[model samples]
Target: MKALQITGAGEYGIANVPQPTILDDQVLVRITLVSTCPRWDIAMLGGKDMFDQTRPPDYPLPPGFPGHEAVGVVEAAGPSVQGLRPGDRVAALEHLQGQGAYAQYMAYRERDLLKLPDTVSDRKAVSTELLKCVVLGLDQFEDVKGKSMLVAGLGPAGILAIQVARLWGARVIGIDVSPERVAAVNALGIGEAVLADSLGDRRFDLGYDCVGAAPSVQNVLDRTNEHVVIFGVLRGELIYRDRFWMNGIKLESHKARPVTERYRRLLLDVLTRPEMNTECLQTKQISFKLYAEGVETLKRQEAVKICFNPQEAF
Candidate 1:
C-alpha cells in the first residue's frame, strides 16, 4: 500500500507501507475521499504548531497522516464490530494518535464511523464530519427563529452556518472580506451576503465568527446585538471594549464534538436533506498523488473545499 508522507516543511511524497490491521472493535475501510484541512495541514507543513500548542513541533508527520474528514467503504470488520458489514459506506473520524484517512486503507473504531444514507451521494456524504461541527455550533444558540443573525467569514463553515441558521428561521446575513466568497454565499439564495467593509451601520441579534482571528472576533463583538458565537479556532488574544460588560453581552466558543451515535444520527439526518447544499461547498477534487498540490491551493485560498480521491491514479 502507498501512503502520503510529509518528509519536511513544504515537502511530501508517497511511500509504500504495509496495510493497517483492525482491532477487535475496529473495521478496515478503503478510503474514497480525504478532505483537506488547510489550517492544520498547512501550518504543520510550514513548521508551525497551530493545531495543538501544548505538543512540541514534530517534523515529517507520520506516513498516512494529516487527514480527518474522510468517507469510504468498509472492506473488513473485526469480530466484535456490530451493526457494520464489509460493504457499509461510512464517514470517518481522525485517529489523532494513529495513521489517518489519507491512505488507501485505514482501521477505524466501529463506533467512530457514521453510516451514510442512501439519499446522500459520496460528494455530499464526504462533508459529514465538518457539517457536524456546524450543526453543533448552531445548536448552541437559543430562540433563533425570526431573529437577525450575522455569519462572519464566508468560508466553508461560515457558509454552512448561514444555511443552518436560515433553516432555524433566522434572518441570516453573511460577511466576508473576499468578494468571491460573498458571491458564493449569495449564490445559495438563502440570505444577504456582503463585503465586510460595506456593512456600514449594520448590526445583528446574533453574530457567528467563523474566522478565529482577533480582528474577526472584535468585528463580531462590535456589530452583534448582544450574543456572539466564536465558531472558529482562535490563534491570538481577543481584546474588547470595557463597555462590553455594561451591555450584558455574551460570548460562546464552540469545538467539534467527538463522534458518538447520537451526534452521528443528527449529522446524517442533516446531510440527507437537500437544503444542506453540501455539494456547493466542494470546490475541487484531485487524485491522491496531487495531495500536496491540493494543500497548496487551499493555503493560497484558491479553493474552498478540495477532496483527494485515493482510488484514482495520478
Candidate 2:
C-alpha cells in the first residue's frame, strides 16, 4: 500500500508502505477518498502538538501518517465488530493516533468508523470531517441566534463554519482574501463572503479565525466587537491581551475531537445536514504524480482543499 509518510519535521512523501492488518477490535478499510488537512499536517511538521500528543504513541512518535478526515469502504471486519461488515461504506475518524487514510487501505477501530447512508458520496462524506470540526466549535459557543458572526478564513473549515453559523440562525459574515472563494460561498448560499482586506472597520458580534496566520489573528481583533471563536489551527506567538481586555472580548479555542462524546453528537448533526454536505467543488484534482506540487500549493494557500489520488499513480 502507498501511504503519505511524514518522515520528520518538514519532510513528508508518498511511499510504498506496508498495509495495516486488522486487530481484534479493528476493521480493515479500503479508503475511497482522503482530504488534505494542511493546517494539522503543517503543525506536526513544525513540531507542535495540536492535540493527540498525550496518547502514549501507539503507531509511532513524532512522524507518522497524519490525516484525520477520510471516506472509505470496509474490506474486512474484526470478530468483535457487530454493526459494520465488509462492503459497507463508512467514514472513519483518522485522528487519535490512527493510521493515515491518504492511501488505498487503512485499519481503524469499529467504533471509529461510522456507517454512512447510501445517499452520501465519498467526497461529501470525507468532507464531513471538516464539518465535524466546525460542529465542535458551534457546540462550544452557546446561543448564537440573531447575533452576527464572522468566519475569518475561507478554507473548507471556514466555509463549513459559515454554513453552520447560518444554519444556527445567525446573520453571518465570511472573510477571506480570495475573491474566487468568496464567489463560491455566494454560489453555495452559505453567507455574505467578502475579502478580509476589503472590509473597512465593520464590527462583528462574534468572530472566527480559520487561517491561523498572524495577520488573521490581528484581523479578529480589528473586527470583533464581542467574542471570537478560534476554530482554526493557530501557530506562533501572536497575542493581544490588551486589545481583548479593553474591549471585554472573549477568545474560545477549538481542537479536533473525533473520539469524545461531545464531538460525536456534533459530527452526527453535521452529517445530517444536506446543505453542508455539498459546500464547495474543487476545479482541479491533485494526482499523486503532482504530490509535491500539491504540497507546494497548500503551503502557498493556492488550493482551498486539495486531495491526492493514490490510484492516479497505481
Candidate 3:
C-alpha cells in the first residue's frame, strides 16, 4: 500500500508501506477520496504543531497523518464486523487514530464508519466530519427557529454554519476577512455575507465564531445579544469584557459531543438535501502523490480544499 508521510517541514513524500491487517472489529476501507484539513495540513506543512503552535512539530509523522476527511468502499470486513461487508460504501465520521486517510486503504473500527445512504454521493459524504462538527455545535444551543445568527468567519466551517443555521430557521448573517471568501459566500446568498468589519453595530441573537482567533471571537462576543458559541478552535485567550457580563450575555464553547444514533440520522438527512452544501470545502482534485502541490494551492488561496485520489499517480 502507498501512504503519504511528512518527512520534514514543508515536505511530502510517498512511501510503500505494509497493508494493514484487519482486527476482528474492523473493516478495511479502500480510500477513494481524501480531503485536506486546512488547520492540520497547513500547520503541519509549515513546521508548526497545530495542537500547540508554541512547540516545534515532530518530524516523520505517522503515515497518512493529518488527512482525516474521507469516503471509500469497504474492500473487506472482519468476521465480527456486523452490518458491514466488502463493497459497502462508507465514510469515516471521525478522524481515525492514525489519520490513515492519506493511504490507499485503511482498517477502521466499525464504530467510526458510517454506511452511506444511496442518495448521498461520495463528494457530499466525504465532508460528514465537518457537518458533524456544525450539527453538534448547534445542538448545544437552544432552538434557533426565529433567532438571528452571526457567523464570524467564512471559511469551510463558517460556510456550513450559515447554511445549517438558515435551514434550522435562523436569519443568518456571516462575515469574513478574505474578500474572495466573502464574495464566494455572498454568491451562495445563504445569508447576508459581507466584510467582517462592516457589521459595525448590528446585533444578533446568537454568534458562532468560526475563526479560532481572538479578534474574531471578540468581534462575535461584542455583537451577540443572547448567547455566543465559540465554534473555532481556541488558539488564544478571549477577553470577555465587564460590560459584556453586565449585559447578561452568555458564552459557550463548542464541546465535542458524542456521536449518538440520532445525530447519525441527522447527518444522513442533511446529506440528502443539496441545499446544505456539505462538500463546499473542496475546490480541486489531484493525485495523492502530488499532495505537496495541493497544499501549495491551499496556501495560495487558489483552493479551499484539495481532494486527493490515491488511485492515480499522475
TM-score of each: 0.92, 0.81, 0.95
What TM-score does prediction 1 earn? Answer: 0.92
Error of 3 at 123 (Å): 1.0
Displacement of residue 86 (Cα, Å) in model 3 is 1.6
Winning model by TM-score: 3
lDDT of 2 by residue, 122-178 (tens): 777776666766777766668789988878888877877877788788888888888
Please give the distance, in angstroms, between residue 108's alpha carbon in candidate 1 and its true position after superposition: 1.1
Cand. 1 Cα-lDDT: 0.80
| Candidates ranked by TM-score | 3, 1, 2
Query: Per-model C-alpha lDDT, please?
Result: 0.80, 0.71, 0.83
- In model 2, the runs with Cα more than 4 Å from the true position are 6-14, 40-64, 96-98, 236-248, 255-266, 277-283, 309-313
What is candidate 3's lDDT per residue for 1-314, written digit by digit as tens? 89898978888788888988888999889988888887788889888898798876788888888878889999999999998999999888875576567888888889888899788888888877777898888877779889988998887788888888888888988898888989987776656788987877889989899888988898888888889989888777888888887889989889986788998887788778778776667888778667777788888877878887776642
